[model samples]
Target: MRADRLVSLVLLLRRRGRLSAATLARELEVSTRTVLRDIEALSAAGVPVYAERGRHGGFALLPGFHTELTGLNHDEALALLIAGSRRGAQAFGLGSALASAMLKVVDALPESHRDIAAGAAERLLIDPEIDLLSRRVADEEVPGTIVAEVRRAVFAGHKLRIHYTAAGRPPQWRTVDPIGLVTVRDRGYLLATRSGADRTYRLSRILAAEELDEPAERPDRIDLDRAWQERSTRFRAGGDQVTVLVRLNPARQEELLDTALAVRAEEAGSDGRLRLSVTFQDSRHAEWALWQLGTDAEALTPQWLRTSLRDRAAAIAARYEPP
Candidate 1:
């Protein structure tokens, strides 16, 4: 409402010292005319607001003026409580810190919102260990010391040396310009540049870490999200990408989707099965996903895949033949 907006306008001016009318409107998500009116309203309400008439000025609040606003509203309080309860905080080794902050938040909330927010937050769960299929989610384990060392380097903008082991490769020590850390799907990754090339390492695969004294050589500003997206796009487009058509049991649709690189098209068959065209990184990837479904999915094309499945099934049957 206007009261909240006025309070926000005062707070913005207080924190920023001085801001242009256009800037205030943009920050408050209102129009310049509305900002002017809010400024007049604040002045009329005995607030020490003043305007600096100049090509480079708009509005300012007199120094030493402050308002004692109460804590957040109910929705804001509940949203923060719910977000703080997520596992993402634990991935960054901030579980204890997050717990402490949550306590402060609960205590600072208006008495009417405190109990309700906490109770509502308690009923929410995010990223549970066990999925709907009864399969346990595997949480990748990384040593706290290793994570702390890498985290220190990332924030300090220093070079770091790490003993890293890629899949099917022996551990090797490499010095890298540390960029930042990212956590997705309950796993952590270190995004950095190796030998001037973008490299992402799974935190679980980092055996040891050492922060170097030399400052890292990197751009002053980085768009980490865009960088990650570009790398992910390159990765998905790499390798012998393959697309396969399959008819899968409707009940197992999620399983197929979870394993495929991407879904191209999907439709329901007259037989009640789900017909889907899915892409995988390669033939091996396609076979792995289809095989996981066993008899629940049938690969409809790439005669070679059909023959491979048939031969594999025959061998399995022979192995279990009555003796």
Candidate 2:
């Protein structure tokens, strides 16, 4: 660890020319005394490191001193830098590792491209904790220990035993052959099979996990995309799916489409509104989504859904009518 820190110290000086002891300490997350000692170590090792005196005094590498670390071009470096900004790695319990790797990546880039690539990456943002309305998007917390165990099983072709908490149910322990992990919309899921039946478990819902010594019963090589698609198709087809026809304001079409499971049909209304026949996971899902749109959308068919929405509106209106 100290060796890596020493190398990073050299690279930091090489890139920035001169940095105060406090700045070096902050960048390397070490004590100022540690930076001073490392500077001496570098100097003793004939690394052309020296310190200046006075208020602006700091450590500096000799002029024209640089290590050769060239490989990535501009675009490639930018892409990698942008990837380092993602929070997806945090979902897999690798946040610290990702940060360290990103630091190493920047250090290894050619000096000519390092600052520009890193600076450009700062301009790009990834996940946001809050939306435009100030409503927060809460990230699901997956235990690092659990994630480590599961990840190890997945990569090592071993089975895993987990205590999973399904919706409105008690936690039950099950042994599974994990295929891979997926993160979507900030939620992480472990794609696995139990008793040869595909099962998806939310990582947050895993109360306990243990990797088994036995090998997993899965293909030697998996195409995760293909596997995920097949499982998704089967899941969508097996759910309590319902179709609802709705008339919505053209501007609100996206809101409806975003929540709908599928758009069965679409047409423009004579009144300039949009007509959409869409599928929902269930009646409750349909009711909740349309209710959010208020006057912007109307349930055209499926009289039961229209009735439910009307009753819901009536209830809300009754509350504020008089008393």
Task: Indicate which candidate wins on TM-score.
Answer: 1
Any runs in candidate 1 off by more than 4 Å, and if so which? 1-7, 10-17, 20-50, 61-85, 240-255, 263-277, 301-304, 315-323
Error of 1 at 215 (Å): 1.4
**Pairing residues by index, what is the TM-score of model 1?**
0.75
Q: Using Cα atoms with residue i matched to residue i, what is each candidate's TM-score against the true structure?
A: 0.75, 0.72
TM-score of 2: 0.72
lDDT of 1 by residue, 118-189 (tens): 889899886788999999988787887898799789888999999999988999999999888777788888
lDDT of 2 at 240: 83
Which candidate comes out best when scored by lDDT? Answer: 2
How many angstroms is residue 280 displaced in model 1 relative to the true structure, after the best TM-score fit?
A: 2.2
